[model samples]
Target: MKYLIFGSKGQLAQEFINFFEKSSIQYKPLSKEELDVRDLDKVVNVVKEYKPDVIINCSAYNQVDRAQSFPEEAFSVNTLGVSNLGITCKEFKIFLVHYSTDYVFDGTKQDFYTEEDLPNPLNKYGESKLLGEFFIKNTLENYLIFRVSWVYGKGKQNFLYKLNQWAAANSMLKIAVDEFSVPTSTRTIVEITLKALKQGLTGLYHLTNSGYASRYEWSKEYLKLKQVDKLIYPAYQSDFNLPAKRPKWSVMSNQKISKILNTDIPLWNEELKLMVREMDI
Candidate 1:
Protein backbone atom coordinates (compact mmCIF):
# COMPACT_ATOMS: atom_id res chain seq x y z
CA MET A 1 0.00 0.00 0.00
CA LYS A 2 1.11 3.55 -0.65
CA TYR A 3 1.84 5.25 2.67
CA LEU A 4 2.64 8.72 4.03
CA ILE A 5 4.26 9.28 7.41
CA PHE A 6 3.94 12.60 9.25
CA GLY A 7 6.68 13.64 11.70
CA SER A 8 9.60 11.87 10.07
CA LYS A 9 12.02 12.61 12.95
CA GLY A 10 9.78 11.34 15.75
CA GLN A 11 10.52 8.01 17.41
CA LEU A 12 7.57 6.11 15.92
CA ALA A 13 8.19 7.68 12.53
CA GLN A 14 11.82 6.53 12.58
CA GLU A 15 10.72 3.04 13.59
CA PHE A 16 8.26 2.92 10.70
CA ILE A 17 11.01 4.00 8.33
CA ASN A 18 13.33 1.33 9.76
CA PHE A 19 10.67 -1.33 9.34
CA PHE A 20 9.95 -0.42 5.72
CA GLU A 21 13.52 0.48 4.79
CA LYS A 22 14.10 -2.71 2.80
CA SER A 23 10.51 -3.38 1.85
CA SER A 24 8.86 -2.78 -1.52
CA ILE A 25 6.11 -0.53 -0.14
CA GLN A 26 6.02 3.00 -1.53
CA TYR A 27 6.08 5.72 1.17
CA LYS A 28 6.55 9.46 1.49
CA PRO A 29 8.02 10.58 4.82
CA LEU A 30 7.76 14.24 5.89
CA SER A 31 9.04 16.16 8.91
CA LYS A 32 7.38 19.21 10.54
CA GLU A 33 9.19 21.39 8.01
CA GLU A 34 7.91 19.29 5.12
CA LEU A 35 4.35 19.10 6.43
CA ASP A 36 2.79 20.95 9.35
CA VAL A 37 -0.54 19.39 10.33
CA ARG A 38 -1.65 22.72 11.88
CA ASP A 39 -1.69 24.21 8.39
CA LEU A 40 -4.88 22.75 6.90
CA ASP A 41 -4.11 23.86 3.39
CA LYS A 42 -0.64 22.29 3.49
CA VAL A 43 -2.01 19.06 4.91
CA VAL A 44 -4.72 18.92 2.25
CA ASN A 45 -2.26 19.78 -0.47
CA VAL A 46 0.17 17.03 0.56
CA VAL A 47 -2.50 14.34 0.76
CA LYS A 48 -3.92 15.42 -2.56
CA GLU A 49 -0.48 15.27 -4.15
CA TYR A 50 0.55 11.90 -2.71
CA LYS A 51 -2.82 10.15 -2.98
CA PRO A 52 -1.66 7.64 -0.39
CA ASP A 53 -3.78 4.79 0.83
CA VAL A 54 -2.51 5.04 4.39
CA ILE A 55 -1.33 8.05 6.42
CA ILE A 56 0.37 7.46 9.76
CA ASN A 57 0.54 10.53 12.03
CA CYS A 58 3.46 10.46 14.48
CA SER A 59 3.37 14.18 15.17
CA ALA A 60 1.99 15.31 18.55
CA TYR A 61 2.52 17.76 21.40
CA ASN A 62 3.98 15.29 23.89
CA GLN A 63 5.45 17.57 26.57
CA VAL A 64 3.17 16.79 29.47
CA ASP A 65 4.44 19.34 32.00
CA ARG A 66 4.90 22.18 29.54
CA ALA A 67 1.38 21.62 28.26
CA GLN A 68 0.04 23.09 31.48
CA SER A 69 1.52 26.44 30.51
CA PHE A 70 1.00 26.19 26.74
CA PRO A 71 -2.39 24.65 26.20
CA GLU A 72 -2.71 26.52 22.94
CA GLU A 73 0.45 24.92 21.50
CA ALA A 74 -0.71 21.54 22.72
CA PHE A 75 -4.18 21.94 21.18
CA SER A 76 -2.78 23.41 18.01
CA VAL A 77 -0.92 20.17 17.23
CA ASN A 78 -2.81 17.52 19.14
CA THR A 79 -6.38 18.71 18.57
CA LEU A 80 -6.59 21.14 15.66
CA GLY A 81 -3.71 19.54 13.77
CA VAL A 82 -5.40 16.16 13.96
CA SER A 83 -8.72 17.67 13.00
CA ASN A 84 -7.10 18.92 9.81
CA LEU A 85 -5.68 15.50 9.02
CA GLY A 86 -8.87 13.68 9.89
CA ILE A 87 -10.92 15.91 7.60
CA THR A 88 -8.45 15.64 4.72
CA CYS A 89 -8.10 11.89 5.09
CA LYS A 90 -11.85 11.52 5.12
CA GLU A 91 -12.15 13.58 1.97
CA PHE A 92 -9.46 11.52 0.22
CA LYS A 93 -10.83 8.19 1.45
CA ILE A 94 -7.49 7.38 3.06
CA PHE A 95 -6.95 5.13 6.04
CA LEU A 96 -5.51 7.01 9.00
CA VAL A 97 -3.34 5.49 11.74
CA HIS A 98 -3.05 7.73 14.80
CA TYR A 99 -1.12 7.07 18.00
CA SER A 100 -2.59 7.98 21.38
CA THR A 101 -1.54 7.64 25.01
CA ASP A 102 -2.99 5.83 28.03
CA TYR A 103 -3.22 9.21 29.77
CA VAL A 104 -6.71 9.68 28.23
CA PHE A 105 -8.13 7.64 31.10
CA ASP A 106 -7.54 8.75 34.67
CA GLY A 107 -5.48 6.06 36.39
CA THR A 108 -8.27 5.23 38.82
CA LYS A 109 -9.24 1.83 37.41
CA GLN A 110 -7.89 -1.12 39.32
CA ASP A 111 -7.74 -3.34 36.25
CA PHE A 112 -5.95 -2.89 32.97
CA TYR A 113 -7.72 -0.26 30.85
CA THR A 114 -9.52 -1.50 27.74
CA GLU A 115 -10.83 0.42 24.73
CA GLU A 116 -14.32 0.42 26.27
CA ASP A 117 -13.31 2.67 29.17
CA LEU A 118 -14.50 6.26 28.87
CA PRO A 119 -11.75 8.87 28.82
CA ASN A 120 -11.51 11.41 31.64
CA PRO A 121 -8.33 13.35 31.18
CA LEU A 122 -6.70 14.68 34.35
CA ASN A 123 -4.30 17.06 32.60
CA LYS A 124 -4.36 19.50 29.72
CA TYR A 125 -2.17 17.25 27.55
CA GLY A 126 -4.50 14.34 28.02
CA GLU A 127 -7.49 16.53 27.25
CA SER A 128 -5.89 17.69 24.02
CA LYS A 129 -4.94 14.16 22.98
CA LEU A 130 -8.41 12.88 23.73
CA LEU A 131 -9.83 15.64 21.53
CA GLY A 132 -7.63 14.42 18.68
CA GLU A 133 -8.96 10.89 19.05
CA PHE A 134 -12.53 12.15 19.13
CA PHE A 135 -12.00 14.08 15.91
CA ILE A 136 -10.56 11.08 14.06
CA LYS A 137 -13.24 8.71 15.33
CA ASN A 138 -15.95 11.11 14.24
CA THR A 139 -14.38 12.01 10.89
CA LEU A 140 -12.98 8.81 9.40
CA GLU A 141 -14.52 5.44 8.58
CA ASN A 142 -11.15 3.60 8.37
CA TYR A 143 -8.69 4.38 11.12
CA LEU A 144 -6.52 2.67 13.74
CA ILE A 145 -6.01 4.32 17.12
CA PHE A 146 -3.40 2.68 19.35
CA ARG A 147 -3.07 3.83 22.95
CA VAL A 148 0.39 3.01 24.29
CA SER A 149 2.39 3.99 27.40
CA TRP A 150 6.03 4.55 28.46
CA VAL A 151 7.34 4.03 24.91
CA TYR A 152 11.16 3.94 24.44
CA GLY A 153 13.53 3.24 21.58
CA LYS A 154 16.59 4.50 19.66
CA GLY A 155 17.03 7.80 17.82
CA LYS A 156 14.75 9.79 20.13
CA GLN A 157 14.21 10.95 23.70
CA ASN A 158 12.31 8.32 25.74
CA PHE A 159 11.94 6.96 29.26
CA LEU A 160 14.71 4.39 29.22
CA TYR A 161 17.19 6.73 27.57
CA LYS A 162 16.53 9.42 30.15
CA LEU A 163 16.76 6.93 33.03
CA ASN A 164 20.07 5.56 31.81
CA GLN A 165 21.50 9.01 31.42
CA TRP A 166 20.40 10.07 34.90
CA ALA A 167 21.65 6.86 36.47
CA ALA A 168 25.05 7.26 34.91
CA ALA A 169 25.42 10.80 36.17
CA ASN A 170 24.01 10.49 39.67
CA SER A 171 25.24 8.44 42.57
CA MET A 172 21.67 8.37 43.86
CA LEU A 173 18.27 8.83 42.25
CA LYS A 174 14.69 8.93 43.44
CA ILE A 175 11.78 7.55 41.41
CA ALA A 176 8.03 7.35 41.82
CA VAL A 177 6.77 4.20 43.46
CA ASP A 178 3.11 4.70 42.58
CA GLU A 179 2.89 5.57 38.87
CA PHE A 180 2.86 2.43 36.69
CA SER A 181 2.58 1.53 33.01
CA VAL A 182 4.03 -0.78 30.39
CA PRO A 183 7.36 0.50 29.06
CA THR A 184 6.57 -0.18 25.41
CA SER A 185 9.30 -0.05 22.80
CA THR A 186 8.86 1.88 19.58
CA ARG A 187 9.85 -1.29 17.74
CA THR A 188 6.93 -3.12 19.35
CA ILE A 189 4.59 -0.35 18.23
CA VAL A 190 5.98 -0.52 14.69
CA GLU A 191 5.71 -4.32 14.47
CA ILE A 192 2.13 -4.29 15.70
CA THR A 193 1.26 -1.52 13.27
CA LEU A 194 2.65 -3.52 10.35
CA LYS A 195 0.67 -6.61 11.37
CA ALA A 196 -2.48 -4.60 11.86
CA LEU A 197 -2.03 -3.00 8.45
CA LYS A 198 -1.57 -6.41 6.83
CA GLN A 199 -4.68 -7.75 8.53
CA GLY A 200 -6.65 -4.61 7.65
CA LEU A 201 -7.51 -4.13 11.33
CA THR A 202 -9.45 -0.95 12.03
CA GLY A 203 -10.53 0.45 15.40
CA LEU A 204 -9.03 1.22 18.80
CA TYR A 205 -6.42 -1.04 20.39
CA HIS A 206 -3.86 -0.85 23.23
CA LEU A 207 -0.31 -1.69 22.14
CA THR A 208 2.24 -2.15 24.90
CA ASN A 209 4.56 -4.66 26.56
CA SER A 210 2.99 -7.62 28.30
CA GLY A 211 3.77 -6.49 31.84
CA TYR A 212 3.74 -3.25 33.81
CA ALA A 213 6.17 -1.48 36.19
CA SER A 214 6.42 1.53 38.38
CA ARG A 215 9.18 4.03 37.70
CA TYR A 216 11.26 2.67 40.60
CA GLU A 217 10.92 -0.95 39.50
CA TRP A 218 11.62 -0.19 35.84
CA SER A 219 14.67 1.86 36.79
CA LYS A 220 16.01 -0.86 39.10
CA GLU A 221 15.51 -3.52 36.47
CA TYR A 222 17.11 -1.42 33.77
CA LEU A 223 20.10 -0.68 36.01
CA LYS A 224 20.45 -4.38 36.83
CA LEU A 225 20.35 -5.40 33.16
CA LYS A 226 22.85 -2.73 32.25
CA GLN A 227 24.86 -3.67 35.37
CA VAL A 228 24.96 -0.03 36.36
CA ASP A 229 25.37 0.36 40.10
CA LYS A 230 23.44 3.32 41.51
CA LEU A 231 21.67 4.19 44.76
CA ILE A 232 18.10 4.37 43.58
CA TYR A 233 15.28 5.03 46.06
CA PRO A 234 11.49 4.94 45.73
CA ALA A 235 9.55 8.16 46.29
CA TYR A 236 6.07 9.52 45.82
CA GLN A 237 5.06 11.16 42.54
CA SER A 238 4.41 14.42 44.36
CA ASP A 239 8.00 14.53 45.55
CA PHE A 240 9.06 15.64 42.09
CA ASN A 241 6.76 18.65 42.27
CA LEU A 242 6.16 18.75 38.57
CA PRO A 243 3.89 21.22 36.80
CA ALA A 244 1.33 18.64 35.62
CA LYS A 245 -0.48 15.91 37.47
CA ARG A 246 0.23 12.36 36.29
CA PRO A 247 -1.88 9.26 36.76
CA LYS A 248 -0.74 6.86 39.45
CA TRP A 249 -1.52 3.84 37.26
CA SER A 250 -1.67 4.30 33.50
CA VAL A 251 -1.10 0.66 32.49
CA MET A 252 -3.24 -0.46 29.56
CA SER A 253 -4.40 -3.96 28.54
CA ASN A 254 -2.79 -5.31 25.36
CA GLN A 255 -5.28 -8.14 24.78
CA LYS A 256 -6.84 -6.33 21.83
CA ILE A 257 -3.58 -5.93 19.95
CA SER A 258 -2.32 -9.29 21.22
CA LYS A 259 -5.32 -11.04 19.68
CA ILE A 260 -4.36 -9.75 16.28
CA LEU A 261 -0.65 -10.61 16.72
CA ASN A 262 -1.70 -14.19 17.66
CA THR A 263 0.70 -14.13 20.61
CA ASP A 264 1.45 -12.34 23.82
CA ILE A 265 3.72 -9.33 23.81
CA PRO A 266 7.29 -9.69 25.04
CA LEU A 267 7.89 -8.78 28.65
CA TRP A 268 8.85 -5.14 29.21
CA ASN A 269 12.13 -6.20 30.84
CA GLU A 270 12.91 -8.54 27.94
CA GLU A 271 12.30 -5.80 25.41
CA LEU A 272 14.26 -3.39 27.60
CA LYS A 273 17.25 -5.68 27.56
CA LEU A 274 17.02 -6.08 23.79
CA MET A 275 16.90 -2.34 23.26
CA VAL A 276 19.90 -1.79 25.56
CA ARG A 277 21.83 -4.47 23.72
CA GLU A 278 21.21 -2.59 20.48
CA MET A 279 22.41 0.67 22.06
CA ASP A 280 25.20 -1.02 24.10
CA ILE A 281 23.88 0.70 27.19
Candidate 2:
Protein backbone atom coordinates (compact mmCIF):
# COMPACT_ATOMS: atom_id res chain seq x y z
CA MET A 1 0.00 0.00 0.00
CA LYS A 2 1.21 3.51 -0.81
CA TYR A 3 1.22 5.70 2.28
CA LEU A 4 1.92 9.44 2.38
CA ILE A 5 2.61 11.31 5.60
CA PHE A 6 2.05 15.05 6.13
CA GLY A 7 3.78 17.08 8.89
CA SER A 8 6.90 14.95 8.44
CA LYS A 9 8.87 16.94 11.03
CA GLY A 10 6.50 16.66 13.99
CA GLN A 11 7.20 14.50 17.07
CA LEU A 12 4.65 11.83 16.14
CA ALA A 13 5.58 12.23 12.48
CA GLN A 14 9.15 11.33 13.33
CA GLU A 15 7.93 8.18 15.09
CA PHE A 16 5.86 7.21 12.04
CA ILE A 17 8.86 7.73 9.81
CA ASN A 18 11.00 5.53 12.03
CA PHE A 19 8.37 2.78 12.04
CA PHE A 20 7.95 2.88 8.26
CA GLU A 21 11.72 2.82 7.78
CA LYS A 22 12.06 -0.39 9.80
CA SER A 23 9.08 -2.02 8.06
CA SER A 24 8.41 -3.11 4.48
CA ILE A 25 6.01 -0.20 3.99
CA GLN A 26 6.73 2.37 1.28
CA TYR A 27 5.76 5.97 2.08
CA LYS A 28 6.47 9.55 1.05
CA PRO A 29 7.05 11.97 3.90
CA LEU A 30 6.20 15.64 3.33
CA SER A 31 7.22 18.47 5.58
CA LYS A 32 5.36 21.78 5.83
CA GLU A 33 7.96 23.29 3.52
CA GLU A 34 7.38 20.49 1.01
CA LEU A 35 3.58 20.75 1.20
CA ASP A 36 1.53 23.23 3.20
CA VAL A 37 -1.92 21.83 4.03
CA ARG A 38 -3.61 25.25 3.99
CA ASP A 39 -2.78 25.66 0.27
CA LEU A 40 -5.79 23.79 -1.13
CA ASP A 41 -4.58 23.90 -4.73
CA LYS A 42 -1.19 22.51 -3.77
CA VAL A 43 -2.75 19.90 -1.50
CA VAL A 44 -5.08 18.70 -4.25
CA ASN A 45 -2.17 18.59 -6.69
CA VAL A 46 -0.03 16.55 -4.30
CA VAL A 47 -2.82 14.06 -3.66
CA LYS A 48 -3.33 13.63 -7.38
CA GLU A 49 0.38 13.21 -7.98
CA TYR A 50 1.02 10.73 -5.18
CA LYS A 51 -2.16 8.71 -5.70
CA PRO A 52 -1.62 7.19 -2.29
CA ASP A 53 -3.90 4.48 -0.90
CA VAL A 54 -3.63 6.08 2.56
CA ILE A 55 -2.75 9.59 3.68
CA ILE A 56 -1.62 9.74 7.29
CA ASN A 57 -1.86 13.28 8.61
CA CYS A 58 0.59 13.92 11.46
CA SER A 59 0.14 17.68 11.03
CA ALA A 60 -1.27 19.61 13.99
CA TYR A 61 -1.06 22.96 15.80
CA ASN A 62 -0.17 21.86 19.35
CA GLN A 63 0.69 25.08 21.13
CA VAL A 64 -2.08 25.17 23.71
CA ASP A 65 -1.45 28.60 25.21
CA ARG A 66 -0.14 30.22 22.02
CA ALA A 67 -3.24 29.02 20.17
CA GLN A 68 -5.33 31.41 22.29
CA SER A 69 -3.31 34.34 20.96
CA PHE A 70 -3.20 32.91 17.41
CA PRO A 71 -6.46 31.17 16.74
CA GLU A 72 -6.09 31.81 12.98
CA GLU A 73 -2.83 29.87 12.80
CA ALA A 74 -4.30 26.99 14.80
CA PHE A 75 -7.49 26.83 12.69
CA SER A 76 -5.57 27.21 9.46
CA VAL A 77 -3.58 24.07 10.18
CA ASN A 78 -5.90 22.10 12.43
CA THR A 79 -9.27 22.83 10.79
CA LEU A 80 -8.89 24.46 7.39
CA GLY A 81 -5.83 22.43 6.48
CA VAL A 82 -7.54 19.19 7.47
CA SER A 83 -10.62 20.23 5.52
CA ASN A 84 -8.46 20.61 2.43
CA LEU A 85 -6.93 17.18 2.96
CA GLY A 86 -10.32 15.60 3.50
CA ILE A 87 -11.68 17.22 0.36
CA THR A 88 -8.79 16.03 -1.76
CA CYS A 89 -8.81 12.55 -0.22
CA LYS A 90 -12.53 12.28 -0.84
CA GLU A 91 -12.05 13.23 -4.47
CA PHE A 92 -9.20 10.74 -4.93
CA LYS A 93 -10.89 7.90 -2.94
CA ILE A 94 -7.95 7.67 -0.55
CA PHE A 95 -8.35 6.44 3.01
CA LEU A 96 -7.43 9.27 5.35
CA VAL A 97 -5.95 8.27 8.71
CA HIS A 98 -5.91 11.28 11.02
CA TYR A 99 -4.94 11.77 14.67
CA SER A 100 -7.01 13.76 17.13
CA THR A 101 -6.47 14.50 20.84
CA ASP A 102 -8.25 13.83 24.12
CA TYR A 103 -8.31 17.58 24.67
CA VAL A 104 -11.45 17.69 22.48
CA PHE A 105 -13.41 16.89 25.65
CA ASP A 106 -14.03 19.55 28.32
CA GLY A 107 -13.11 17.07 31.15
CA THR A 108 -16.56 17.41 32.63
CA LYS A 109 -17.14 13.65 32.62
CA GLN A 110 -16.52 12.02 35.97
CA ASP A 111 -15.28 8.84 34.26
CA PHE A 112 -13.38 8.13 31.06
CA TYR A 113 -14.70 9.62 27.79
CA THR A 114 -15.90 7.35 24.97
CA GLU A 115 -16.31 7.93 21.22
CA GLU A 116 -20.04 8.61 21.76
CA ASP A 117 -19.28 11.49 24.16
CA LEU A 118 -19.87 15.03 22.92
CA PRO A 119 -16.79 17.23 22.53
CA ASN A 120 -16.69 20.64 24.18
CA PRO A 121 -13.12 21.87 24.16
CA LEU A 122 -12.03 24.34 26.81
CA ASN A 123 -9.09 25.92 24.94
CA LYS A 124 -8.50 27.28 21.46
CA TYR A 125 -6.07 24.46 20.64
CA GLY A 126 -8.66 21.88 21.68
CA GLU A 127 -11.37 23.70 19.74
CA SER A 128 -9.20 23.70 16.64
CA LYS A 129 -8.51 19.95 16.91
CA LEU A 130 -12.19 19.18 17.55
CA LEU A 131 -13.14 21.17 14.44
CA GLY A 132 -10.54 19.25 12.46
CA GLU A 133 -12.34 16.05 13.46
CA PHE A 134 -15.64 17.53 12.25
CA PHE A 135 -14.13 18.53 8.90
CA ILE A 136 -12.89 15.01 8.21
CA LYS A 137 -16.10 13.31 9.42
CA ASN A 138 -18.26 15.60 7.30
CA THR A 139 -16.11 15.64 4.18
CA LEU A 140 -15.02 12.03 3.81
CA GLU A 141 -16.61 8.61 4.24
CA ASN A 142 -13.41 6.50 4.23
CA TYR A 143 -11.48 7.74 7.25
CA LEU A 144 -10.12 6.52 10.57
CA ILE A 145 -9.70 8.97 13.42
CA PHE A 146 -7.89 7.97 16.62
CA ARG A 147 -7.99 10.27 19.61
CA VAL A 148 -4.73 9.71 21.57
CA SER A 149 -3.61 11.00 24.93
CA TRP A 150 -0.31 12.15 26.52
CA VAL A 151 1.95 10.71 23.83
CA TYR A 152 5.64 10.39 24.75
CA GLY A 153 8.89 8.92 23.38
CA LYS A 154 11.69 9.99 20.96
CA GLY A 155 10.50 13.60 21.45
CA LYS A 156 12.30 16.35 23.35
CA GLN A 157 9.17 18.30 24.27
CA ASN A 158 7.28 15.42 25.95
CA PHE A 159 6.73 15.24 29.71
CA LEU A 160 9.07 12.31 30.32
CA TYR A 161 11.94 13.88 28.35
CA LYS A 162 11.59 17.24 30.13
CA LEU A 163 11.17 15.73 33.59
CA ASN A 164 14.15 13.43 33.05
CA GLN A 165 16.31 16.38 32.05
CA TRP A 166 15.07 18.59 34.91
CA ALA A 167 15.36 15.91 37.59
CA ALA A 168 18.90 15.21 36.45
CA ALA A 169 19.98 18.81 36.97
CA ASN A 170 17.63 20.15 39.63
CA SER A 171 17.27 18.98 43.20
CA MET A 172 13.61 19.96 43.49
CA LEU A 173 10.54 19.83 41.25
CA LYS A 174 7.03 21.27 41.51
CA ILE A 175 4.41 19.39 39.45
CA ALA A 176 0.69 19.88 38.96
CA VAL A 177 -1.40 17.37 40.87
CA ASP A 178 -4.78 18.00 39.21
CA GLU A 179 -4.11 17.24 35.53
CA PHE A 180 -4.69 13.53 34.85
CA SER A 181 -4.49 11.31 31.75
CA VAL A 182 -3.04 8.07 30.50
CA PRO A 183 0.47 8.40 29.11
CA THR A 184 0.85 6.51 25.81
CA SER A 185 3.97 5.44 23.99
CA THR A 186 4.47 6.50 20.38
CA ARG A 187 5.55 2.96 19.45
CA THR A 188 2.39 1.49 20.93
CA ILE A 189 0.29 4.05 19.07
CA VAL A 190 1.91 3.19 15.73
CA GLU A 191 1.51 -0.54 16.36
CA ILE A 192 -2.14 -0.10 17.32
CA THR A 193 -2.83 1.99 14.21
CA LEU A 194 -1.29 -0.64 11.94
CA LYS A 195 -3.11 -3.46 13.72
CA ALA A 196 -6.42 -1.63 13.53
CA LEU A 197 -5.96 -1.09 9.79
CA LYS A 198 -5.20 -4.78 9.31
CA GLN A 199 -8.37 -5.59 11.29
CA GLY A 200 -10.42 -3.25 9.05
CA LEU A 201 -11.42 -1.08 12.00
CA THR A 202 -12.22 2.43 10.78
CA GLY A 203 -13.89 5.35 12.53
CA LEU A 204 -13.27 7.50 15.62
CA TYR A 205 -11.76 5.64 18.60
CA HIS A 206 -10.21 6.76 21.87
CA LEU A 207 -6.67 5.35 22.17
CA THR A 208 -4.54 5.56 25.28
CA ASN A 209 -2.92 3.39 27.95
CA SER A 210 -5.20 1.14 29.99
CA GLY A 211 -5.00 3.40 33.07
CA TYR A 212 -4.55 7.05 34.10
CA ALA A 213 -2.30 9.26 36.26
CA SER A 214 -2.03 12.83 37.38
CA ARG A 215 0.90 15.02 36.36
CA TYR A 216 2.47 14.68 39.78
CA GLU A 217 2.01 10.89 39.93
CA TRP A 218 3.31 10.42 36.39
CA SER A 219 6.37 12.59 37.10
CA LYS A 220 7.26 10.72 40.30
CA GLU A 221 7.16 7.41 38.42
CA TYR A 222 9.52 8.75 35.76
CA LEU A 223 11.88 10.19 38.37
CA LYS A 224 11.78 7.00 40.40
CA LEU A 225 12.61 4.86 37.39
CA LYS A 226 15.50 7.18 36.46
CA GLN A 227 16.68 7.08 40.09
CA VAL A 228 16.68 10.87 40.28
CA ASP A 229 17.01 12.37 43.77
CA LYS A 230 14.81 15.39 43.14
CA LEU A 231 12.40 16.51 45.84
CA ILE A 232 9.09 16.61 44.03
CA TYR A 233 6.21 18.73 45.38
CA PRO A 234 2.56 18.79 44.38
CA ALA A 235 1.02 21.94 42.86
CA TYR A 236 -2.34 22.83 41.34
CA GLN A 237 -3.02 23.97 37.77
CA SER A 238 -3.93 27.40 39.11
CA ASP A 239 -0.43 27.67 40.58
CA PHE A 240 1.00 28.11 37.10
CA ASN A 241 -1.83 30.37 35.80
CA LEU A 242 -1.41 29.60 32.13
CA PRO A 243 -3.09 31.42 29.23
CA ALA A 244 -5.26 28.43 28.21
CA LYS A 245 -7.80 26.83 30.50
CA ARG A 246 -7.22 23.07 30.88
CA PRO A 247 -9.73 20.28 31.51
CA LYS A 248 -9.36 19.08 35.09
CA TRP A 249 -9.89 15.49 33.94
CA SER A 250 -8.50 14.32 30.58
CA VAL A 251 -8.65 10.50 30.80
CA MET A 252 -10.15 8.75 27.75
CA SER A 253 -11.55 5.22 27.42
CA ASN A 254 -9.77 2.96 24.92
CA GLN A 255 -12.24 0.08 25.19
CA LYS A 256 -13.71 0.66 21.72
CA ILE A 257 -10.42 0.18 19.90
CA SER A 258 -9.32 -2.60 22.23
CA LYS A 259 -12.54 -4.49 21.69
CA ILE A 260 -12.24 -4.23 17.90
CA LEU A 261 -8.58 -5.20 17.84
CA ASN A 262 -9.07 -7.76 20.63
CA THR A 263 -5.83 -6.45 22.12
CA ASP A 264 -5.00 -5.58 25.69
CA ILE A 265 -3.38 -2.25 26.53
CA PRO A 266 -0.87 -1.80 29.33
CA LEU A 267 -1.42 0.52 32.26
CA TRP A 268 0.20 3.97 32.25
CA ASN A 269 2.73 3.08 34.95
CA GLU A 270 3.42 -0.25 33.27
CA GLU A 271 4.32 1.47 30.00
CA LEU A 272 6.33 4.16 31.80
CA LYS A 273 8.41 1.61 33.67
CA LEU A 274 9.06 -0.31 30.47
CA MET A 275 10.15 2.83 28.60
CA VAL A 276 12.39 3.96 31.44
CA ARG A 277 14.11 0.58 31.48
CA GLU A 278 14.36 0.30 27.70
CA MET A 279 15.83 3.77 27.19
CA ASP A 280 19.11 5.09 28.65
CA ILE A 281 17.28 8.02 30.28
Question: Could you say which candidate leads in lDDT?
Answer: 1
Give the per-residue lDDT of model 1 (tens digit) for 201-233.
Answer: 998999999889999999999889888899888
Per residue, candidate 2 scores C-alpha lDDT tens digits across 54-105 of 9999988888899998899999999999999999998889999999999898
Per-model TM values vs. the true structure: 0.97, 0.96
RMSD of each: 1.2, 1.3
Q: Which residue pairs show backbone clashes in model 1?
A: none
Best by TM-score: 1
Candidate 1: segments with Cα more than 4 A from true spot: 279-281
Q: Provide the global lDDT of candidate 2 against the true structure.
A: 0.88
lDDT of 2 at 133: 94
Q: Which consecutive 10 residues in model 1 have the weakest lDDT in total?
A: 152-161
